[model samples]
Target: MTRSEVRTVLLDAVRELRPEFAGLRLTGNEHLGAELGLDSVARVELLVVLEEEFGIEDEVDPRIFMTPATVNALVDQIVVAEGVCR
Candidate 1:
């Protein structure tokens, strides 16, 4: 899938985990944990959701989920890795 597609899927997953951020704007520079106030539990929840949605067993580091930009960047990397694996 393209980066845009990955972003859309990731955003949907995030919204599902945090309905409060459903309408919030998620830009490349936004911080997922700090800006959205997602604690460790919430971050794990998001990872689980993303795993299910993407259907890939990713080695998602906790630090990468610290921010929206980081998450986006990580997802991009994961998509490439998964594509390579496929």
Candidate 2:
């Protein structure tokens, strides 16, 4: 997978996992909670889903998941670190 692919996957996963957040156009740097009306539980759920979906472990910094751009950047970093992408 490439960076764009990772972004697409994350975008789709986010949209699917949080139907209440559906229809909100997410862009890089958008606040995941305030912008999407997500509570702490939903945020944690998203983190878990993202970890499982991407096969990432706990090394991911908690702060990096705060925003869509940061999340995408973190995923890209993990993909590169794990050699999951070219």
Best by lDDT: 1
Please give, for residues 7-33, the per-residue lDDT of candidate 2 as tens digits: 666666668767865787766345555
The candidate 2 region of ten consecutive residues with least summed lDDT is 62-71
How many residue pairs clash in each candidate at the backbone level? Answer: 1, 0
Q: Score residue 11 of candidate 2 by CA lDDT.
A: 65
For every candidate structure, what is the RMSD over all alpha carbons to the true structure, in angstroms?
3.6, 4.0
Q: Against the true structure, whose TM-score is highest?
A: 1
Q: Candidate 1's residue-wise lDDT over 1-86, tens digit each?
A: 46676677667766777788788877634566666566767766766776666575565554555444455675666555445223
lDDT of 1 at 32: 65
**Least accurate stretch of 10 residues (summed lDDT) in model 1?**
77-86
